[model samples]
Target chain A: MTLFPRAVNETTSRELRKTFRSPSEIFYPLIFFVLVLTMFPFSIPPVPGLFNSIASGILWTAALLAISLSLETLFKADYSSGALEVIHLSGANLVLVAIGKSLGHWIISGLPIALLAFPIGWALDLNFLTLWVLVITLMLGSATMSLTGSSISALTVGLRGGGFLLVMLSLPFFVPLLIFGSSAATNASLGIVPEAELYFLGGMFVLSLTVAPWATAHAIKIRLG
Target chain B: MSKPILEVTNISLSRAQKLVVRDLSFSVSGGEILRLSGSNGSGKTTILRALAGLILPDNGKVARLEEKLGNITTSSNSVIYIAHRHGLEENLSPLENLNFLSQVCTPPPIRDGVSVLETLGLKTSMHVPTARLSAGQKQRISLARLLMFDAPLWLLDEPFTALDTSSKKQLESMIDAHLDRKGAVVLATHQRFNCKSHVLKHSLPMIP
Candidate 1:
């Protein structure tokens, strides 16, 4: 909290912008989400009551998984191009750098994802609380996913076929987020209070915000060294 | 006219599990150009990486100028590290490469990509994807770093590789200008620099 350290996230934000703008990167996850949901509707026979009952859980699960996959790009590109070293050498604080980039990730991947997911909910006929809860849960939950996933991504950068490796490394950390994300929506579906799940999710999000950046920032330094 | 700019009391390096360099000691005053020559796997790149503070040395300390020397201690502007990889994104053009490099590095005298390429004899291919450029051209793009960075120390590993005679001459002159400005260097190259004045040579054995 010292004023000596200027909080400019310029380098981190610029790198994040580059990843989000890559031609090969954009649109795949959103398309994948739509395609995956399309499968559930086809596999199960058309029963509107059945679909409505399970809609919140199903939609939130899809959102969580899709955003997890997208967070893999956070540090891999920076590592490969030697830009990560440059960032460290820039003498900016490692924690602020990590936070700035993670916030940008939530903006690009998580927010648009929530916006897209709501319309998909209307298609699946989700109720009002389920809609807002899903959006809120996903926004908070995906930030945790992205921050912790950055540590996993940095560790596996040079490994062959690292995408699968990253998921395997990070899935254990993400289990709580997934459980709360689905149950919050599912509990809301039953017209019951989901405040416990929401509060737990909120606590996990704060813990991630507090510690995940330092872990990830040091992880990059160790990987580079 | 006082203390030397660099002090390496005794430095040793180990990569992975094996000791590649050990118990070595040397120092350079300002404006000195020191060349390191040896066969492949002689640990030239490892030493260069260590000097740039990329890889930590196992046992020694490296101190730059003292506080009285007006050195910006935390800033990396005092030294620049260059190697074959160019450390550039291939998908981006040379112009974009300059922009990205400038964004990450600290404040310095920035140069246009076209002029950098021109000085390295890469004028016609400045806008091409670096992957499309030849090996020599890519090396030139990497060395274009010299144009933008005004560091006092250049830790160059194999800086002369894949360069034509004229390109090599250009680099030699560039290093000359660097030394004339009181900048020092630790250059590792297989090819001959052939500069007689103000050059120090250190040869290492290629460990079996």
Candidate 2:
């Protein structure tokens, strides 16, 4: 008990460093997010009002998808090397470990990209307040996405077809978050107000908090068996 | 001098709706060495997992020393089970591996990790990552865990697979020392060990 949270924190930080040290992996997704968002302004009609109207939606979905890109790496190495077994056997609360692992993953793939999206948002002619709001919203939203995606990834770590299976299984989950997040962004663009979407997003985040770690832990046990 | 360290009664396990072990029962008193001998898929690994409480048995009982053993009661960190897979981080050296395990687990008093490696016959290459070690070296490192875990019960699956003759004899001596201290060992091995007096052997049939 004296050492558990420290251990969890240490493990999370270690995972963060490991992921960030590899520059190729870090920048590729961020660049992909930018490039995908850039494609949007050209594809749709060239009115700033129209672009801004759905721009928040596009950016939010892009942020959500970007977080999903690196989910496989969350537990694949640990699970493969028998580290998970040692953790499971150590009498540590597996839920805390699950949460730590999920958080570690968010640090690696979600946080930085969301932070950097601010300048990118400004370049898209997004309202300054909306851009700041979008940045904060994606930071919170994508971190949640990364955490949930990691749990899903851990659940399918060694299973055959785990890659496609993760997407197929987790997309339904992402829909509600996507709808609410983008709608909030969309509402911001049209000045439709933000409080209701914020409340809904908060509710979803809380719901995922209650459910995802437990689901991930159960999946790990099944995969371990 | 004391009660048995472990007790199992009428334990059965089924994986994926197929019975792997049925009505299997065994007990190891303090300082006794029990070897589970069976052909592949005879529930040797299954039994070890059940004893460690890593797997729940549908119809059985297991009691560990100072532990109220059951499906959920297994959160205790006292017993250690090393699987056929060895449960090691192959990227780390023997010392590094032990250090990592010690951080996460309650370790036996071996002082330093390398001293435990010395006991396992790890030589100059002892400091190299386990990926550089031969299969036998890795096996020794895996077994070296016994030197670091003060736990009385050892649930080892095929601890002798890649061991050399001298290493195997060292293992025998270690078992002797553990028994002298009243520590019990539950092992699944195909190798023929020469501890005739202290051993109670159970043969597992492939079909049952």
Candidate 3:
């Protein structure tokens, strides 16, 4: 196997193990995702026509917030316990490490939210076809969000009150993904094919995968320096 | 005399835009221990970080000679660095941590994880979460990396801070054995390292 994939796999497995060691950490983002989505129904009217119109926007926004909240933890623990120094000295590809961590973050936080989106959309009166589109779009968009947020998390890992900075830095980047994802879901609800929005979401996902790891690696190096 | 395996020439480093290490230079060959002695905040740890390739010196060169390949491994895979904080996860056992370390390490160490924990007197704490371990115990767990990596050079920062008397003796012996095996060490510490073996020791005194 090539070194990049091998290193990425090793880092991913370690990250997964560390994440699961605390059950609360593993479930916290998903819980936050559900809670934020639940609150939308109360704040907005539960009338079928009104709820369906706003549901896609509400779901994307909630996923964005939950994923961002979870990212506060991406590098903080490693930085605090000095594990990151060991990793730096290990001579492994830091880019691979960054990509692997983002992968793990997506698996734990993004994947579950995407899976749960179908049922949540059903409760919001979205039809089966639209619900399916919601799941796919969420999966793509959340993965992109995780990748983008990973870079910001890496940059702010050790700073005092970095959590606030994380939101400030990443929230603007999220605007594009939100626009594309919610548009896809809304078009699906309107019985349109939604292909263009889905294509845009996939393009963003691909762009994030290509760029986020390198950006995150540079961020980590700057923080360590 | 054996060729110097590691050399640092006239390196200067800074933190927070203020210079900490100014015009520093040192080298060590196989079977030698370079002890960086100084009071707190004297840039001992920063210098070690520079040596371990964690950060680059603002001015100067750090070169590590590769004995087998004749290629320099300047900032990668040739040095093992133990920083002030133990890197082991608080929720994971020593065994798990070592296993994870082995996975990430390039050209992994030959020592078995079980034997290394046992040798470091971590036999009882092998399966216990590191957070439950005492400070000295955690330090010992960090020191266990000496047995877990194949790197020829070690950069240790205040490795004896939390160790008790016996653990300190044990660590010294471990360092002695490492030197005996032709591995070099650069240790930054305020405590005296007791080694009965006839090994070359160079003390680099730092100005506070």
- Best candidate per DockQ, number? 3
Among the numbered candidates, top TM-score falls to 3
Candidate 1 local lDDT, B97-172, one digit each (tens)? 6655555445644675667777777777767766687777777777877877677778888888888888888888
- lDDT (Cα) of model 3: 0.83
Segments of candidate 1 deviating more than 4 angstroms:
A1-9, A16-21, A38-52, A90-93, B67-74, B100-137, B164-166, B194-196
Can you list each candidate's DockQ?
0.32, 0.31, 0.55
DockQ of 3: 0.55
Worst 10 residues of 1 chain A by lDDT: A1-10
For model 1, how does the per-residue alpha-carbon lDDT over A69-175 read when each residue is reduced to its tens digit? 77677776666766566556534466766776677677667777777877877777777777778888888888788777767777777779788888777888888
| Best candidate (score: lDDT) | 3
Superposed model 2: Cα runs more than 4 Å off: A1-4, A17-53, A190-193, A222-225, B75-77, B89-100, B106-137, B164-169, B193-197
RMSD of each: 4.2, 3.7, 3.0
lDDT tens digits, residue span B36-94, model 3 = 87666778888887776667888788877653322223233578888899987787888
lDDT per residue for candidate 2 within B1-208, as digits (tens), equals: 5767888888888877878888887788877989998888888888888888777788878888877565543332467677776556555567766665555443324456778887677857666867778888887877766777677787878888888899888888888887888888898988887663469889887764
User: What are the per-residue Cα lDDT tens digits for candidate 2 across A1-225?
Assistant: 345466466467556555554557767668767777778878988875787667778888777676676677777877776677755764555666677788887776677777876787787787766776787677767767876786789878977887778777777888888887777776776666688878877877777777888888777776765
lDDT of 3 at A110: 93
Classify candidate 1 by CAPRI docking class: acceptable
Scored against the true structure, residue A46 in model 2 reaches a CA lDDT of 85
lDDT of 3 by residue, A1-225 (tens): 355577788778878888788878888988999899878768876676786788888998999999888888889998999888767766556788888899888999999999999888898789877899889988999899889999999999988889999998899999998998898888888899799988899999999999999999888877876
Q: Which ten residues in a row have the lowest lDDT in candidate 2 chain A?
A: A1-10
